[model samples]
Target: MSGMSSTQPWDVQRLPRADDKVFLITGGNAGIGYFVAEQLSGTGATVVLGSRNPAKAEVAMAAIRSRVSSARVRAVRLDLADLSSLRTAVESMEVDRLDAVVHNAGVALDAPPRRETGDGHELMFGTNHLGHFALTQWLMPLLSTAPAARIVTTGSFAAKSERLDLDDLHSRQGYRPKRAYGRSKLAQMYFGLELDRRLRAVDSTVASVVVHPGGALDSLTPSRPPVHARTTGAWLRMAPAALLVHGKHAGAWPAVRAVLDPSVRGGQLWGPRIFGLRGKPCREPVWSQLTDTSVAARLWDASCDLTGVDLGTIPG
Candidate 1:
């Protein structure tokens, strides 16, 4: 249990080569996603941003370009809230194969009440978990082209609030905004870990890893609050430190490390080395002994059924 601080062991600057490599980052326009893209693209990787709003995507691309004069970056439309959007974006992208798919996009619905996506699934469940679930499955084949493809999905410290709520995953029974958000994040971790298990079973080149930002950075102060009040407050306390102590690169380090670090262990969690909720990058444990393996198995089947994506060819 490391605590948040200025000192940490691993840093992404040590990475050797990223030139010519291709990467796709969901929600790459802002927050840790933006930093992840910046770090990778600065190193010469061709980073494609997946954003819900095409216009915002362009703006994000421009911002990154301004920072990294020679950064290779592009933006494409990707709406996790709509299954159709995810399909359209993936089909339209021109990359033959991706070196990594950073599954970082997620949503939070606070206080007002439970909401539903265009596909009628619980907003949090659909956007945060199912949306990325489908995207990763669809792009799984393209990832195999790389020597060691990685899938870095974002989770949250809030996941500790509860286990998988299989009976009412959509929060239909008792819709609590915070609870729904937590459930979605928990699902992400379970799926990420399970995907790793599947990859090992099939000996696939792709590896699934999960990371959490611990908290938001102060730079995001103006933009971060509206995402979700409860979530914002839960993470805001760490923002000052996240910004002052870690900055953009530090905020994005968990996912960046999870994606590019060869030493990253499949199914292992990474986050701020200090309090884990906030600090620099390092390996951290998240799952409990009672995490419900059966739920993981069932959720995999349910995701395939929900997304109409075939997992038969992929590992278990």
Candidate 2:
């Protein structure tokens, strides 16, 4: 697989059977997350769609059931912006083992003005990085119980242009919306890569992989009942559907591949083949900054400090 070119074919059709596996996807109620859930559930995995909104989660579950009658799926409420909510959500999970956890939920392009989460951290950074950091650490035990688990963190093309300001992780200084979003994504990638290194050092079976969904647009995503509403506006709304290169389902391919592809390895990054805007999933090169161990280690320590959670060493 390593010798294959970037355009090598990979899609939902190639996903392995997951009948005995159990997986959780944060923000699985809509967009790329929703499609990831649908595809995985269709393959017989017991999928937990973690969302902040119960109604939206139920709608996503229904959509999956409607599409795949045999889908084994459920919904759980999870608000990445709230640490209390993250804890409650983890406690409520009944599964004894988690085969994989896909960190797919996050704030997108039009993030609101710089603000703080309930924990007093910047909203974008808190929700996108700190929340997942805490959640993944808290769930480490369950993940270790599985024979071979995976932690899939969703990254973005924006990370290529952003640099992490370690001193100002909260964006206390000048905070542009796009730059903030990029910084959060870069943090996420760093966490995933750092996690893989730590897990390997401890001889753990869990793999940590980062993936980018390219440029998935809600305008191109069909809405499900009871929650999501379809794109309803003038040509401006439909313009994204027509202009964006790929659909939401296609955007999910990279994360899906990260989760299930046997050839994928720990610390690897995946994204679209065509400049990360659109195209099939492929193993993409990591940004030079993300590959720096010193930076990753610093980010890991900072995340533990900010979130007040730690995975310790891998379970024996």
What residue runs in model 1 are displaced by over 4 Å at the alpha carbon? 1-9, 13-15, 219-249, 289-291
> Ten residues in a row with the worst lDDT in model 2?
1-10
**What is the per-residue lDDT of model 2 for residues 102-168, given as tens digits with 9 covering 90 to 100?**
9989985476567788899898899999999999877888999998899999988888888899999
**How does each model score on TM-score?**
0.87, 0.90
Residue pair clashes in candidate 2: none
Once fitted onto the true fold, the runs of candidate 2 whose alpha carbons sit more than 4 angstroms away are 1-9, 109-112, 222-244
lDDT of 1 at 232: 60
TM-score of 1: 0.87
- Local distance difference test scores for all models: 0.78, 0.84
Which residue window of length 10 is worst by lDDT in model 1? Answer: 221-230
